[model samples]
Target: MRRRDLLLLIGATAGATAMYQAMTRLGFAAESPYRGPITLEGDPKGASVIILGAGLAGMTAAYELARAGYKVQILEYNTRPGGRNWTIRGGDTYTELGGAAQQCLFDDGLYLNPGPWRIPYHHHAILDYCRRFGVALEPFIQLNHNAYLHATEAFGGRPQRIREIKADFEGAIAELLAKATRKGALDEAVSKEDQEILLEALRAQGGLDKDFRYKAGDDAADFRGYARDPGGGLAAAPSNGEPIGLHDLLTSRLWRGLQNFALYDFQTTMFQPVGGMGRIGEAFARQIPKVIRYGAKVTAIQQDDHGVAVVFEDLHGGGSVEEATADWCVCALPLSILSQIDVNVSAPMKAAIDAVPYASVVKTGLQFRRRFWEEDEQIFGGISYTNLPIRQISYPSTGFNAAGKGVLLGGYTWGGPNSYELTAMSPADRIKVALDCGAQIHPQYASEFETGISVAWHRVPFTLGCAGEWTDETRRQHYGNLCQIDGRIVLAGEHASYIPAWQEGAILSALDAITRLHKRILASR
Candidate 1:
């Protein structure tokens, strides 16, 4: 959505320095001093920190650490900065192709407040970022009906409970999944037995496990055998697969660890920025020294007793690998994407990176010629649906003037689809699917789309998906890998920060790691 639309929404609706920040700047978001290489303030010779990736997580960490006198070098895979937290511009106006949406969310009180944009609570790095930069968060705008799922076709009475929503899923085997969870997680402790049963069910459904960890890719197929087969519903398939994989069936609670903020859990939600989500990333980007590099990809990472060396590949056109070394390095890149990179880290670090997988998200952004669908009532955040692939159709340009007359609509699909598939699809096909869904709600919008494009994060090479997924094995293994490698390779980013997968989580992770590294550096002095 564009800017002018927001002004028409409600005229409508609407923090301090945070403890983690070094110094507070009024109105400006605080940038944490702990983002990059470890540095002690009193030293004449500064420390060198090689940061991988220039996304929000990497940028914030570099910003914080550099301010405290750490000389930093950032290597990014994308042609531009901002990894999953992406911003796209057609001409002058822009919209995010990927990332957590939020801005200016910390205050001088060191107290955190809700901002115009809503980020997942699990993301500790974001709060840490706000504290460092001193951006204050306002209250999250109350959404309508907490629309878990809304459609014009009318599904029926409201769910008696959240489980009912689960009951109504399109996957006929959903009930079997719920039943399997009970029989698998608790009823039967035999892990291997549970795996087989789940696989049978998933195979019966159109499901495929991208990671071959548990021989999961074997027998991956379409959902035909058990499409609500009552007999199959009652009987459990033989439980067997990789013991370390997700149960064929599971509960939504698994995601709480990732989002914690209940953002994805609720179906219908439209968040407008108090300022704008872009401002948040921009704020973090600003605090770092102007030396930050863009379009640099790290091809090889090697470390020795002296320091760590990194190689970069230019993303724009001509290619030359550049190398730089640092006393310490904070790797803020997403593990799901970074796993493929040739980094000479230990087996455990590599395994850890491979362990926490991300969810593939296909977001379709549509811009209209005019207020095509905003008739009857001036609608901003439109209906969320069960009938469509896209969860919600929102008009983000609800307020503001200078931003202009624009509308943004999207179709979000998670891991249910295949990897590397969407990237191969044409932009027209992606937009057609999104608009088709939107038309289901307001039948009037079937053909009025102006220009549309889709974001297939799974194919982004540098970011396999939009955010973290709630796989059984993934949840089990995320936390143990948070520490640095032999006290040198510090980890930062939404993935490394223990915040699941939100921008705030990225900031907090950077702060925590930086603070810890900061202490380590000071102690050495």
Candidate 2:
């Protein structure tokens, strides 16, 4: 949807609440860092820019600059468009760091987005790009009340429904607070008038009874769900499940994962491209195909006052070093790899390049013969968190209520010893570990599992690591140096933005970089 249409639709709404909801559903709820389509007001006078890495950041820069009448060329390390915005489907092959290649064995129409899987509602820059590129999107279910939260050491390795845990925890907290208020334990903290209002609010919020007790009854069932759902005729009456005691709930420590669903970033109205995350990159590729040269890996970068020159190897043909030069350069390459390259930049910029470390993450996708999680467990679309090395299992958000095969994100281990350990293992062993860990929560994994693929970000050749891990001190010291226009070269990518490891960050950083570059070009002319 265009900005004007979106504004008109929201303006036509009855109230702010309705407008907010409508804007969310239409993917225009948040204020974008991008002010609609960028228009480079001044001419570049045939200025040329060579962008490294054909990821979202580079493509975005190339797209905007080319439209603004600049000679734009994108040198990509991989043969495909999207860098981490990638997808693995049947018949596709991936080679990791150890020279081990794995061919995806997923069934047709099934795929795994090892990198960026969901677009948060607030990431308006990416959302706008998706809308403009005609990339179809579907709701990315962030929180499914039916999903499970399990810890092998807790609850005897059994998984609890998210709804039950959430309702019971809140209900228990409300009851305790209410009891304390009534007993005048909080007399000093809360006034009598406020105490009475608090008690009333707690009763309603916690599904408490007349005596303000959370127990097995219709009121509690309305929040925690029923032991047996209400039905027609003779069995119409609902049975309430007993609220878990505070002690048991606290000891389980499953409450730690519950807050994830409540975080503002993962709230409702998230989305993903209909087929895969790669659709975004492919769409961008369609707009500027000729300008992007795939399989061109940069080895050295040098910039003089006149222009910037990049030396790279043609990976597809024999590894012959080739040089590409332009009036300016936007190096979107990951800092992890860029730090190692021979780039002629100021000392601080080079130090800034090495200051930020890349994150390590491993993701495993398992294909099952049937939708057992949906049919047997009633888990439609959401993530099930666990303390195991596998971390989380996310059910596919697409293909809901459909009969046939299904794909599950069996494991996603981010950082720590687990990521390093998984990356060190062979692809088959990594898949095996994911299966073993997942089976602890979903026993059907042993039987229902058919084939799987795992991608360890550290092992990903295109990017040595997942994303730049910046600290407060690092950002304070080096962020400006890293982003500043160094001679005729500048940097742009997720690493350059405050919100790292997100597509929105990459696009925003690109937009910022290009805007500055365009200004410099106009001044030069």
Candidate 3:
């Protein structure tokens, strides 16, 4: 079966968490390979290079190349930096491809990151940049035991606490294993001594009683939580919560949500900028403000052995035609847009550009009158998974336990029929759908919702989609050509790296591309 079909099967049968695992295993995600700051040993001798797009990749190239004594200028389509590393704040406005515009009404200090938000500890390149630029970082909570996992048909559509499901599932599995071991079921696979040790370990792991049973008692309550409080005064005695039977737990399929917390990409120590994800882009733009020519949309790219010239329309200057010439070029534009622009390159490079498609995703941000998830539900941060078309709801990582209005990532859906369906609707309808679906998980959504804004990445005017959606077959066929320097121009972005859909990939791809370009330039001299 095709990769998408296989993933759909996994998602349908197993769940989103399982589908993500399969993606990672199939090379859809990978760790960054940044060791340290790159040093360009050779001099560029004032060689001029024009970079396309002022996103992370473009700015990273400009920063490094300018530091290496190269004259770098960047042309960006948007009037601001950070292509998809964006944040929507109060008073900010956005216009999609179909001319639907939205003016954000979030309160001060509240914003929504429609694109990349969290940075894993292992993404050293972005973290190094954040450190170098002095962008304040705070922990991004990916898993909160108090958060929820809901299946429409499970438990009469009632949501269950993550901690409850996790503890009960583990306890149930452990009890069964212990029973089998005690009945000599593992005698063929293990020695009697090892079997005894395993039984002891299982009891501790499952919070089972001395009788080797998982029951409603103090032992099980230790891991699964107590039904009543253990207070300092009278009536302080705690009561154990009943463990869900193994059959019910299995049938509920809530265990599918447990794997997400264990995924390497989303493990603890994840971080976001103190204010918003846009801070990283703002920091980069601050370093080289003069080099960026915002609102310049590339129309055509042509090159020869001597140098390269680019044709563009200055959207800020009455859409006048303009040209930029340089000795070299690092085109960091997204493939979704880049493929459509007239660019002179090898047939193979052009084919590579057209081969990769971008992923469709929709994210909706809702502002509420109060932080109900924190005030009422006590869910400070983290995500709640569901089988609904919205896929998941991620609570804000910042502004924990604050009093006034708050914004929640009310709905997030990856590439699927749901994403396309959401993308087809107007922004208003998307927000309404988000509110309706989210109300099922948190009934307070209907009452507390103030305003909301939704972004269907495919409808975005600039990127036209989310990140590059590469398959194993496409990567095998076109990834090499896409990265190769076609004459004086080379490509760099998340699309050119193994770790697609991440800032680290863009930075690393730029670093690698420019490093090779510098070497080639030095060799020519």
Candidate 4:
């Protein structure tokens, strides 16, 4: 099915779509018992594994480690687990507060915003997990999210019509895409990730038409056409265990075969979980056997002959010094937070994580007594590309008995007046900043909430920012350097994976760390 139709089917389901997509693509239809837990239970003590965070990555590693028969304990600083895939609820529905962002765009609009922002069934890890779990799949959706470019300079609350900047915007992007398919290769089966990445590289270097806009327009379809590449839904290469590089396969054809769709928003799309994205996290948590040490901030990790000693602080109360000695440890804390961990790792590991550049994103949730957007005459939910302080907003709480209107209005806010100053602001001030800036997106934003809380990861004690990666080669190498030193200190986080900042990355990295730890545990015997 087209990505848009898939989205509609998903949104129609409410919020359970993400997990469904993950499962379906991975081929999980009936591979395992859907209602039961699949664990890796090994023996304790022989290879006690201490997981440093309860985020997806940490928890994933824990589940895999546990089923392997290793005693596992997960330590986290948050009062709750799920790390970035956090969910906040009002009525019956809960919206992801941290990492997972949902959308309302449709099939062809997979690359569009407020939906499948850019999930192509290309990542082997995402597909594999989905199949292993038995979740179903759906495509994307397309509502009013048809946008080609977006101007950060401020247009208005609603997205500008495509006719507004036809010349400099759509014209250039269309011409550019045509050039990719024209390159001569890509006709044969190749990994989508490599193809898109190569095309993007060429597009950026002026390989195509250079008549591009200095700034993106409301219709990000033009610029992000290159950005909305579905992940090369692919399997790992036999030789390297990495997805096959497009450079290896499609290098001969170039971009001569691609096509551009009409609904072109650059935002992420996702089928509204029949329930919510939160369901996916809950699923993983249920499957995993873990004791999350909430509010227990890891301070240090020291390694020696026997194993590793993890030093931590119980941030929930009076400070106390506690240490857990484990045969191995997996550090699944955020890279930003990891940098703050009191223990000093090797200089290279520290430098690598420290060097990753994180984009500051503000996620603010506004609770409304009713569903204002649903009442609006313009369209249904799946609001995208608004010219406001908020990047995108969807009525996430549309269907729920307890939530009343059950409205979830959220946005991705970046760079604006006092954007930098937010770091020093108080909670009240930050909320005001989000609300004040948010007001530009919709007046309801300024005056809507009875009361709301804005969780700025930038201001979060340990987490500094959102999904961005390091460009420096040295920094990238640092991620690999951080592993269990002889099965004692493992590192797992968004930063630890090739695809950093995404939920899939967190789980994938954890799996890697867990696999290694599991091997060590078994080998020791």
Where does candidate 1 stray beyond 4 Å? 1-45, 92-117, 120-142, 145-276, 400-404, 418-424, 470-472
Clashing pairs in 2: none
Q: Could you arrange the candidates by lDDT from highest to lowest?
A: 3, 2, 1, 4
Candidate 1 residue 424 Cα shift, in angstroms, is 5.1
* Reference-based lDDT, each prediction: 0.53, 0.92, 0.93, 0.53
Worst 10 residues of 3 by lDDT: 26-35
What TM-score fits each model?
Answer: 0.61, 0.93, 0.94, 0.61
User: On TM-score, who's better, 1 or 3?
Assistant: 3
Global CA lDDT computed for model 2: 0.92
- lDDT minimum window of 10 residues, candidate 1: 107-116
In model 3, the clashing pairs are none
Compose the digit string of candidate 3's lDDT tens values, residues 1-525. Answer: 998788878976898888889988886664456888999988788899999999999999999999999999999999999999999999999999989999999989999999999999999999999999999999999999999999999999999999889989999889999999999999997899989899999999999999889999988988989888577778889888899999999999989988889998899989999989999999999999699998999999999989999999999899999999999999999999999999999999999999998999999999999999999988989999999988888998887887898999988999889999999999999999998889999999979999999999999999989999889999999999999988899999999998899899999999999999999999988
- Any runs in candidate 2 off by more than 4 Å, and if so which? 1-32
lDDT of 4 by residue, 95-167 (tens): 2334433232111111111111223333445445555654443443333332222334433223332222332
Q: RMSD in angstroms, all models?
A: 18.3, 6.4, 5.8, 15.4
lDDT, residue 370, model 1: 49
